[model samples]
Target: MIIVGEEWEELAAALSQADAPQRVYVVGATNSGKTTLCRYLADETATHTRTAYVDCDTGQSRIGPPTTEGMVVHSRPPDPPGRAYLRFVGSTSPGGHFLQTLTGAKRLVEKAAELSAGATIIDSPGLVFGGVGVEFQFQMIDLLRPTQIVALQHGRELERLLANFARHPEVAVRRIPVSPAAVARTVTERRRYREERFTAYFADGLSQEIPLRGLGLQGRVPDLKDPHGVERRLVSFNDPENFALALGIVEEIHPRRRALTVFAPPFDPAAVASVRFGSLYLDLDADPGSMESSRP
Candidate 1:
């Protein structure tokens, strides 16, 4: 069962008020129960009108798979999580790509807005600890211009980060309490979660030979022409608009035929408009080596 604290109850009440937030930006430090709070708020909002959630937490993500910023609309209360629209960030963590993260968030928010949901909740990454984390939060707040800023601070650690919004009278800044039942995940658990997600995503296990000449390629290490360059390397297949269609793992890079033998879930070859070589090399059939950084 989910633990709902009194403070969470208060936040939910405020969110349910007639004049409550429409575009709610949920932010918090790592392991501060941000996702839990967002889920609660979404459930509450769904009681009244259509609720849309844009899940931006690539790691430990619920709405979308890892390394993706995704959106889902809750037309009714207690809507089960599903991937509606997604943009790939190429990494589980947003350490190296703040701009990309921000861009993807903005695009997803725009998509959410178009849906005209009564309540739009944005679930952000818990990267609110360092310089990059601070900047990412700042840029997200500035770009989204959300109606309310729901920050889940464990303590004063998030003060400096929330300083900018402190003076914004128009923006309702909510300081909610983190649930006591919130448990911090160990490093081993996180890795296992990623591996499990990857395994489940490619469970159907597709093996297709994709011609390299048609799709645009990104990243450096795995040159499509190089023999065995992209073998076992994770990749994101994109549509023409650059939205991620599916995740893939390279089985073999057929240099002679100018094609990639990749294992991806069922997808149309014509729709595979672009390809990006990621740093993570996950081999469910084999060992996903000790170091699986998302930088190719």
Candidate 2:
């Protein structure tokens, strides 16, 4: 029977007594550092145990190609004490990208279970696209029941994700809030750079140049829409108002999630990357020649 509820501790105890390893699912938006964090966590757990890393970002796989031409059980090496990093890449490239990633993730999960991995960490793709993303999240939760799920969010995407995951019984969700210290550092650094650069540049006087072509010369055929002209006039970034307006456009097209949280600070890529699973270390207390390793 499957274990469930606030029995995370019980689950851990059961797994510890059991031979197989625990499994975790790492998910977040693109560029949210899900892969980097998973690598570090897996490597850390590798010592005194075997760990596997699975990449489900099939649309843009970070590790290797998707496992094809084999059943889930046959995907890993036919040997003991072996670590397999699973990934899925659609060779055909048909269907929507999110759909591909979701399907790939299901396969990865099945493979992880089959391998009886001591622990498996799965890194997933960004959740921004509409229906596909929702389907992906639900399917993953239903299949994995990950002991833990680490979600990364940047920009305005977090609210949407929070609202969706809030209803899930299996998820132990936490928000990694943007750090106050980081904000302070950003402001200070920007202020220093502003003082050093803005003074001299703005002192010399600045103005934007917009070019206009005469319709008479081009012979306006009553009414004609110029693709090149519209492309050239695409949104400008230098203006804050324009940037805000662009965000509004996105929000309109894709509604934001309804909930929010202020938990841990945003993940620090450098710190997370620095976390090594296995490295040169003398386990003087116990086993010798046992080195720990993990990804950056």
Candidate 3:
């Protein structure tokens, strides 16, 4: 049911001949088949050895819910991919949370390396234009130090950005046309997709109260003086090491009691050492809203 163009086939063949432990960073605009290409490459590379698929596209995430970078290690062919590691970025789009996005991607990529994956394929978000987008891509490429970059663009849309890395001897860049099968999605559809993902993630969630006394907070911390400001805000319950254990939706903030009521899937509250707040607010029964921007 997936379409693989000749260019992708050639790229795969070329990669097969290269050295082991390949770090491939894939970039493309929205609906340009970035995920599809990463999936195909992971499957192809897994046949030889363990392959890691790093999902940096937080908006349209594949391994975990939106606003989190996730990684899956494929040990063999036909491996049913699951979230092996997750890092919270706090926003669906990487616009305002550039540092979080870059940091999460780096951590996940490092995790993939730690697993000794033969090939690590990173799928980046489709924010390849504008000042922020260009800078983000540049920072990510410099930080991750990918062995190769597969740029899928319509015409010369990415030429300006790719120009910066053209002479980088350490990284090889490949430009390919967007797949013919790629379909552009409307804003409404993208929002709906995110809503569906959030809804499914919390389908069986139960309300639990978390004490804020010893909990470290990250990202956009809510105003404790105004309890309603944190209502329905998306958040992540992180382990001691700061890795996300599970996501939660703030149902209520008990400022006086120094506790938070969150609706999240079953998770050990004791394991949560910190609470990372996101800019997005979701009611589950209604469309999500962003405190950072109008996105999603």
Candidate 4:
């Protein structure tokens, strides 16, 4: 069960006061009850009208696996929500893949709008400090242009970023103290959570050889000179429109055959028009590995 305090009631009332479409963006530092608040808001809104919950927190995504922005539409209470529409960001963090992260978020949020959702609640990643963090958050807010922003902070941590939006007439910013019950997670616990998500995502995966001839390659394209370099690397198979069909791991790359052997959950290989390689390499048995590379 989600735990929310009385502070959320005001936010709920504000949301309820609006009859027009509401796009609420939830922002906070790590373990600041952003997700819990999002859950509460989504559920409350869904009870009245169609609501869309957009999970932009690629690291600890609730609607989809890590490294992808996920969205789910609910016409009623989301007790057991339907499958999420996913857009792969190609990284667990947005620090290096800013373009991909922002693009994915915009795409999912737009999709929610197209679905005619009365309320779209966005949950963001905990990247809200430092030069890169501040810039990324600012760009995201500018790009999404949410009708309301719910900032949950321990102190003035988010003021540096939220201050920029204070005077924006189109957007309303609500600041709430970080819940006293919010508990920080250890690094080890976070790693284990990602591992579990990756493991579960590929649990029913099968190895298939997908020809690379007509496919558009993206992200860290494997060097043909280093055939085994792509092994164990996470990748996403996208359709003609570049929407992710599913995620896979490069099991093998046959240079001569001009094909890639990928282990992924059941999906139509015929529908894959592009293969976007990710920086992460998953070894199910240990911590995920990363390869530094330029954004796709």
Q: Predictions ranked by lDDT, top down?
A: 3, 4, 1, 2
**Model 2 residue-pair collision total:** 13
Total backbone clashes of model 4? 0
lDDT of 1 by residue, 1-296 (tens): 67998877786676667454388898987788888888888888777777788889887878667888888887764556444887877778887767777888998888777777777888989988788778889999899888888888767777787889888877888887677788898877887787787778888977988888867887544654555545677778888867788888788887777888888899887888888766666667655534354422
- For model 2, the stretches where C-alpha displacement exceeds 4 angstroms are 1-21, 66-100, 129-131, 167-169, 177-296
- Candidates' C-alpha lDDT: 0.78, 0.38, 0.85, 0.84
For each candidate, what TM-score against the reference? 0.89, 0.43, 0.93, 0.93
Q: Pick by lDDT: which candidate is best?
A: 3
Screening candidate 3 with a backbone cut-off below 3 angstroms (N, C-alpha, C), the clashing residue pairs are none
Span of 10 residues, lowest total lDDT, candidate 1: 287-296
Local error of candidate 2 at residue 6 (angstroms): 24
Q: Where's the lowest-lDDT run of ten residues in candidate 3?
A: 287-296
Q: What's model 3's TM-score?
A: 0.93
**Candidate 2, residue 83: CA error in Å?**
6.4
Candidate 4 clashing pairs, residues 3+ apart or interchain: none
Q: Over the stretch 154-233, how does candidate 3's per-residue lDDT look in tens digits?
A: 89888878898899988899998998898789987787787788878888999999898988989898788687667778
